[model samples]
Target chain A: MQLFLLILLGIGVLILQSAFPFYLKVAGVKPDLLTAILTLYAFIEGPLPGARLGFIYGLMEDILLGRFLGLNTFCRTLNSYLVGYAGQWLNPENPWAPTLLAFISVWLHYLFLLLPGRLAGFRYPLLPGIVNIIFPTALYTSSLTLILFILLRGGVSWKRGRRKAGE
Target chain B: MFPRRRYSLFLWMLLGGLALFLMGATGWRRDSLGFLEIAFREGLAPVQKVVATVGSRAYGWIEGLKSWRGLQEENRALKRELERLQALNIQLEEHRLENQRLKELLHFAETQGSDFRFVAARVIGRNPTNWYSTLTLDKGERQGIKRGQVVITSKGLVGRVVKVSPNTAEVLLITDRECAVGGLILENRTPGVVEGSPEFKGYLQMIHIPKEAPAEENQRVITSGLGGVFPKGIPIGVIVRIVTEPDGLMKKAIIAPFVDFDRLEEVLVII
Candidate 1:
């Protein structure tokens, strides 16, 4: 049931990413909900399930784009695995952890994504893109991560607490 | 704990290697994954279509809420432009009649005649990646929307259909790095290829302009019909700047596309 819910959540995030507006974009960079979700999930669930979920969600994202197949899968899988392992030492209940993880993971994910593309003879404006595009995107995703984490974790507990109070 | 950690690390490495292999192989063996891609897209397209409808409506509401004052200013400007266009329309009608008579006398065929059949489609989804620009349309093979079909709006050329399923199609936008359109300067008839910029999103560049050719800022660029996909005379963009390529043998011009890709809601696929 938990696996099913996670998959559903991943799909929901993917759909929302598509539906998101350009108005919400900062410096032409939109928040990455998938990265935030995977980061938090990895923090909560640990390495194995996190890696698997990342791979599945990343593959879906790549497939949806219909190009550079498996490119996102590799980055997301690797980032989630690392984040999961790193997160084992940190407390998931710490609200700041997910935001910090999101900021760091976005940078790590883009590096993994860009390195392979560069090796394949693709040219990207590495320094300028990092400064102008990638960094802004990471910040945007991190800010969004805070909200998502609160809703995912805090909202659930609040509901439980309310139910206990009602009883 | 150390052994368990070691096993996890080893497994992650193996998965990483597998992903790298897939990435390397995708370029060479695209056909291997074609079926799976089509199936996934088709399966999800219906839901995307519904979601896009609601989302666009919501976006329209938000835009309407914020743009009332701006719309009033725009309305006045449009009225002024309309009066000017009305005068120009009379002159253009005379020119059109003269051109039609000449074409009839010379027995010239219309370039976009029977050969061009258009399939109208709604923009249903957008690619989540920042690096690439793509749009998913709610029309597909069932509607005669095929791979490589040129997509356009009444305003200008939008893109080309890259992947198609039975009920949906993915259009690689003109701003995407992978897309290239055969283009010509409308004023001088200088031929060039309009390609997307990797460094810049939402802008295109027309490359391989002949050396010493007159390329001017704000010059109209249109489809040259050499691509065999896009029809001739379709407005692409205006040349914003002329810059020499690094090779020194050619020059490139930055183009600002006429169509607002961010607000694109619907498109016509030239079947």
Candidate 2:
């Protein structure tokens, strides 16, 4: 049931990511909701499950984009696996955990996506791409993750209270 | 423990290998979509279209509310501009007729052929990632929007159709890194290739201009039609700045496009 809910959430995020960014763009960059959600999920779960979900989400994006078929999958899976591994030691209750993880995840995501293309003789200006796109997007995603973390925690506690009352 | 670790390593290796193979297969461009990809895109396009419409309308309402206080003053300014344009329209109409007569004398119609047929499409969604500047249109193969067809607005050039489904098409905006067009400076007739600049957002760079070419700021740029992909004489943008390359071989002009890509709602694809 939780897995089903997460998939629905992924679809909602994908649709909103494409549609609502027209209005929410800052400095020509939009927050990456997928990275934020994946980071949160991986931090709560474990490496194997995180990597599995990452592959699924990344595959959906790749199919929708219809370009660089495996690029997002590889990047996202690696990001999730590493984050999930690191998350085992960190305190998920700390607000900084998910925010920092999201920031780093998005940063690494761009590097993984671009580095291969750059090696293949694609002329992506590395320095400008880092400054103009990668940093802004990471910052935006991290900020969004912070807010989502608080909201999610609040909702979880509320559900817990409701279950306690029923008991 | 040792066996479990080895099994995990094997899984990682398998995932990596599969990813590498898929990447190698697709490369920079995938000329066509697989059946599954087409089916998914077709299935989701309608939902996307409805969401985009509702979102834009809500955005418009919010903007309207925010600017409610200034509407009367804006309306007055618009009225004045409209009156001036109405007077100018008469003069332009006369000049247009004269130009038509001149075109007949020069047999321009035979040389240029008929005007292009256009298929109008509404923007349904944008590229999900910031790495690419692309928009998905509601009309596609069924509407005769083929890959490489030019997309434009009333103001200027937008981009070209790169991917098409039965009910949708994707346009690579002129501001994206991969897009390039042959452009000419209207004032001096200087020809150069305009390419999207990564350093800046919402601007293009006109490259390969001879160092001695008389290109200047605010000069209008138009499609040169050298490339068969785009029609000639379509307005592109105005040069806002010019810079010399490090090697000093050529000059580059920065163009501010007439189309406001952020606000683009509808586009016409040259069919």
Task: Name the top DockQ candidate.
Answer: 2
* Docking quality category of candidate 1 according to DockQ thresholds: acceptable
Can you write out model 2's per-residue Cα lDDT over B24-43, one digit (the tens) per residue?
88777889988988999999
Top of the candidates by TM-score: 2
User: Where is the poorest 10-residue window by lDDT in model 2 chain B?
Assistant: B104-113
User: Which pairs clash in model 1?
Assistant: none
Model 1 per-residue lDDT tens digits across residues B1-271: 5699899999999999999997888887576567798899999999999999999999999999899889999999999999999989999997897565445423322344566666667788888767768899999999988898888876789999999999999999998777889999999999999988655567899988877999999899999999687889899999888888888989889999998999877677787
TM-scores, all candidates, are 0.68, 0.72
lDDT of each: 0.84, 0.87
Best-matching candidate per lDDT: 2
- Candidate 2 docking classification: acceptable
